[model samples]
Target: MNNAPVRTVSDAKRDFYSHHTRPINSIYRRVVDELMVEMHLLSVNVDFAYDPIYALGIVTTFDRFMVGYEPEADKASIFNALCRSIHSTPEHYRGDAEAIKAAVSGMSLDDLKGQFEHLGEGGEGLRGTLAAIAHREKFKYSRPFGIGLYTLVEAVTPPEALKEKEAVETLFKDLASRLNISPDKLQKDVELYRSNMEKFAQAQEVMKDMLAADRKKREERKKAAEAVAEGITEPVAAAPEAGESADSPD
Candidate 1:
């Protein structure tokens, strides 16, 4: 028998917490914890092979969910910890995501769609990976995979094109068909991802407005205090005696 040590989900959680000792903001704590568990479970599964798309999904998910995370530096620390927990490198994931982005940088929506359609011919980057996924008999379809696909679609499609909901839906449905993936599930996952992104943006805007308001209040208080101090030091005209006006003789 081999002497390799066995790893468990608890071990992964412990490792991550140790590295990221700072408390996560309450708003994002659940998301971060769940993501850690999910990654750990997937990493330990024999059937789950790491892929660049999955890496992109993880990175994208973390960045988007962790927007406005306090102690902003902890964001990187948390990500690094999560990757190490799974015995993976953070840089590898980031680099792969960048590579995929670069590969599809200038392609139009149709060009990217064609890449998915004829998967075996798109070469060694995302195209090759898509082909591999398509050929795998028991491909493990996960939320991350859906997110990764969404990321790719967003990269190629123009901002204006994305607004055409029917067109976008048809593109995803067609891609799902070509990949032999579940059309409904893929569509739903992408829709949820987009929805969450919009919510996050709205939440950030609210937070920004609140912070600005708080800062303004503090500044106003500071100005008022300065005015009070100045008033105390400066001489003031005596109040008008009884009913006599200040303009009257006195």
Candidate 2:
């Protein structure tokens, strides 16, 4: 019988919380837990191989979803816990993501696209990785992989170009074809990711408004207390309404 320990999802979850120690805000607790579990499962899969793209996906996903996480310092703790839970190093993931970003930085859309098509000599770094994935018939495709592709496309395309739905669709379609991946699935996954990002942005805006309102109330109460201390009989002037707002911890 094998003597090696068998790791389960619960084990990974336990490890994560142990590392984090501090409580995750209720709003983001589920997101952190689910991400940990997903990473654990993928890491344990026999066919799963860590790659720069996957690293970029993990980094991007965490950064995006964990925006406005309270005690800002805890974000690093949380991410470290996440990577450790999967028996991986956070630095490796971050370094790879940075390298990939640097590779495509200042590259035109066409030049970036060309990296996926040809697997010739001098094909190294991101180009080699993409070509290998394209040629591999049994390559495993996951949601994170799709997100990685989306991240790559977004990195190369101009900000204004992304607003044009048709242009974005055509780019993804062409990429899907080159990679021999299902166009529908890739496109759908990217779209879903984009939709979730939009929802997160809306939620953050709502949270910011709520925090601003709470801060205003607190300031008003403080002024009232000061007035009472001064023995003033008249009502204190209303606090001026300010347009500035603080980020919510949620």
lDDT of each: 0.84, 0.84
List model 1 lDDT by residue over 129-217, tens digit each.
88888877777777887898889888888789888889888988999887788989999998999888988899989987876897799
Q: Tens-digit lDDT track for model 2 on 107-179?
A: 8888898887766443788888887777776776778888887898899888999889888888889988887
Model 2 ranges with Cα > 4 A deviation: 1-6, 120-122, 215-250
lDDT of 1 at 36: 92
Per-model clash counts, in order, read 0, 0
Off by over 4 Å in 1: 1-6, 120-122, 212-250
Minimal lDDT window, size 10, model 2: 241-250
